[model samples]
Target: TTLLRQIAGFDFPDSGRITIGGESVERVPVEKRRIGMVFQNYALFPNMSVADNVAFGLSVRGEAKAVIATEVQRALDLVQLGKLGGRRPHQLSGGQRQRVALARAIVTKPRVLLLDEPLGALDKALRVDMQIELKRIQREIGITTIFVTHDQEEALTMSDRIGILRDGRLVQEGPPEEIYNRPKSEFAATFLGDANIFRGDSTGDGIRLADGTAIAAGVGAKLAAGAKASCAVRPERIRIARDAGTPDGNANMLKGQVSKRIFAGSNSTYFVERAGQTLKVIVQNTGMERLAEGQDVVLRWSPESTVLIAAN
Candidate 1:
């Protein structure tokens, strides 16, 4: 929020430059920068009708009443809230209020839109609905947008690009899939999603697990032998079987006992313990024979499933 505030000119950065639409905006006032912001709380004025709220930006700019009406209606329609314009914020549902706030921000056609956890306050079902709605509106308008949220799934679902910030520095930035699949550091790997970390010394082909098991490195892994390294694999990439044929030598395989199994409707997560290390595997719920606790199983995954990251 503070970063957005600085870019919106509500607060000035101590150093560094802010540019929008090819113009420097460090010294520009908040209202002059043409950057729209939607607060997490929706921040709609309770006293104003949705139409009036949407028109506030253009009205403050001295747009004619006729023009304001047309633009406000267009903005409301863009957000699919056109019919609710006459309703006050208090009368609208959470999702409706969020849309009104978004409409208010974008009615002026700002160069950029900043959404600060715009769906954070909504119920889970409504949050999912608004995520789709927000993405659709963004695409339709073709406006440059920056969304800030701590919801990993939401970030993965809604973004064309992603930037992960930590300790006040940008630790990683890339398309969601790229960052999620090939994170550069341990922090990036675990923060973006769940990762099973295997820390060991690099062995050119891959890292030799602490148990002295040689697992093949995933594609695109870059590390020199003898250096400390870590490999990450998502639980879903691992396959577990109770009596599958022995895997080829090229495959990374381990024999373990099912220590636990968690059922989650669409899938089941199994915790397999082998050589004192616990490995996680996720399998779709296909109504097949499910592994029970204490059952012996083999976990197998291809080299492509592992992601190498900096140990530090």
Candidate 2:
């Protein structure tokens, strides 16, 4: 929120510059920054009709009545709320009201759109629908959008490029695929998604766990021997099996006993205890027999699924 506020001119930066469209706007006032912001709360007028709420920005700017009407309809249609212009905030659902807020923001054709947790108020199902709808509208208009979301799934679903901030500093920035598959740090790996982290000493090719289990890194991992390092493997990448016999091929393997099992609708999560550490593994419910708790199991996965990270 602080970053969005700074861009919207609600707060000034302590140092450095804020540029938009190849121009500096450090001293620009809020209203003159050509920014459209939608807060977590819709902030619509209770007594006004949808059209009037969307027209408020243009109306305040003394835009002509004809121009306001045209722009308001255009914005409403863009948000898929064209037919609800006569409705009041009280008559609309949470999603509809959010669309009204978006229409209001875009009617003025601002250079940048700032969304501060716009979907925070919606329920799970509605939030998913709005995620798709929001992406569609963004692509249709082709406006530069700065979206602020704490939900990792929302970030992965909506972002073309992601900037991860940690401790008031930018830690990593990249496409979603790169950040997820090749996290530069342990924090980034576990933050964006679930990771089974194994802390150990680097062996030039991989890291040797405290139990003396050698985990080979991915194809391009490069680390000096005898350095503090860690390897991260996502839960879904590890496969669980009942057979104790070693499998063929150059796959990493571990022997553990299932400590706990959770059955979600589409998948099952297993907690396996090995060498005083609990490793999580997720297996899709593919009609195969589920592994029971307290059963000895073999965890197998390709070395390519492992990501090596240097300890901070």
Candidate 3:
């Protein structure tokens, strides 16, 4: 109820401002806003065949029969579901039904499109297909879209820019590359992907862990020295080298005993334990060079790959 009232152009001081196409939407009507929405659960009428469903929106608009048919066909063609128009929702696959719902929302050529969990109901393969299809549709239509989903992967894969929300407040918003590579906060870093948060305790140029193992974290040791600061690095960036000799530099090397290793076909994960903390490293599948299950390996990372996360 509150959302509808707000989207209908009311403003709440605490919630901040909302805008569309350079204009403030505080006084715009739903019809004038030109926004389209597609929900989860394939919210199509079960009894309505695919063609009727596509034409439903045009019919409600009092468009001519000839125009409705043309628009319906165009919409179906847009989603690549034209051939299945004669079939009902029950007759179509989960992916196909979602396409019908998408066609209905997009046929009007609205200025903005909003999708709420559009591919949640589909299986993995179907979900991947729909992800590409949705990206293509948004690009071709050139509509400013705001997609809402709890899945970070979906948001990262789809949006032109991601708006990360938490606890009813927007915490971060940025391009996918920035969000993935250089998260502004520690929470955003851990929430979006796998991050190993470690504390750096150092006096000068030397950084030591809890167990007195000194290493280089690629940081200058000026900011994190004396004061406790956090370090964050991606799993894939942690390289496993089997050399017995110690690393030349002290900035980004750590000695860890391989505690657990799991092979998942295309990729593998290693859990290394040192100083009572488990660090993770992701290895790729190069059939020729599979890492062993148990090896006291040196976890190495480059200065560029290590992200010095600030203490919260």
Candidate 4:
């Protein structure tokens, strides 16, 4: 209900201001906001041609026929579908239909555009291509867009700033790298990607693992000694097989037995077991002897790379 209901007055503590061209729009009308929205589906009329659908928004606004034709042609050309103006939604492929829908939304010349899972309907390859297309179009138009997507890659690739919403609350919001590399909470770390979270024990001066392994991380020193802590390291940063010893600056190294291995395209993921729990590590087809299951391996990560977080 919280997500469905649009309250009359609700302002988040910190989502930046809702402004358009330097003007505060706290009480602006929804339609007058000049904000265009593109939904998951193409939302094109089956009976209408590409030109008619692209011109729908302006026609609804009671614009002149000449203006509508001009805007429609320009919008169609923007999507590279000018030659398909006579084709209806039924005649167009999924990707082509989406392009038409996008052209329609932007034809109104909105200051801000909102995209709700815009590429969700396309297949994997088409989705990736559309993701690039969407970003390219956004850059070309230069509109401040707020995109909603469940795909992490899409959000990180397209959005200038991503607002992660969970359970009706905005959990985390930041640029792609900041949100992915420096998560403020454990939830953020795990949700954004796979993480190797280990229980940390605070030493008198620094933080260490529960197994008496000390990390070179000084940020966790803010916590009192003997305090419980939580630390995380990304799978990609952990080296699977490195001659069974320390490599360099990665002070946090743990020896674990490979319990399971799963191949995923170019990268193969391994589940390692240590200290009665499982940890994950990903290795991109490095010519190292294909790590076999049940083989002992050392998980290595840089001291600075391991995110030292407080126990939540």
Give the whole-model CA lDDT for all candidates, comma-separated: 0.88, 0.91, 0.76, 0.77
Model 3: per-residue Cα lDDT over 1-312, one tens digit each: 234345534333345566777788766666667667787886899888899998887888889999998999999999999888899999988888888998998887787777878888888888989999999988887877778776778878887798777676667798987877776567887888888777766534434567665544454224646666566778988777676355455337777788888888988988988778899999987863555657778877776665555556
In model 2, the runs with Cα more than 4 Å from the true position are 219-221, 244-246
RMSD (CA, Å), each prediction: 1.4, 1.3, 3.4, 3.5
Could you give the candidate ranking by lDDT, starting with the highest? Answer: 2, 1, 4, 3
**What ranking emerges by TM-score with the best candidate at the front?**
2, 1, 4, 3
Q: Candidate 4 regions off by >4 Å?
A: 1-27, 203-206, 218-222, 246-250
Question: Candidate 2: RMSD over Cα atoms?
Answer: 1.3
Candidate 3 lands at a TM-score of 0.86
TM-score for each candidate, following the candidate numbering? 0.96, 0.97, 0.86, 0.88
Q: Lowest summed lDDT over 10 consecutive residues: which window, candidate 4?
A: 1-10
For TM-score, candidate 3 versus 4, the one ahead is 4
Lowest summed lDDT over 10 consecutive residues: which window, candidate 3?
Answer: 1-10
- For residue 266, what is the lDDT in candidate 4? 88
Cα shift from native, residue 101, model 3 (Å): 0.8
Better model by lDDT: candidate 2 vs candidate 3? 2
Ten contiguous residues minimizing lDDT sum, candidate 2: 243-252
Better of 1 and 3 by TM-score: 1
Write the residue-wise lDDT of candidate 2 on 28-143 in tens digits.
99888889989999999999999999999999999999999999999999999999899999999999999999989888889999999999999999999999999999899888
Compared with the true structure, what per-residue lDDT tens digits does model 4 show for residues 1-312?
222111111232234445567887656655566767777887888888899999998998899999999999998888889999999898988899999999998999987777778788999899899888888888999887777777877778887887777777788888888888877667778888778777767664346776677865533326677787677778998887735663566456678899999998888999999889899988898565788888888877776666667777
Q: Give residue 76's error in model 2 in angstroms.
A: 0.5
Q: Which segments of model 3 are wrong by more than 4 Å?
A: 1-15, 201-227, 244-246, 287-294
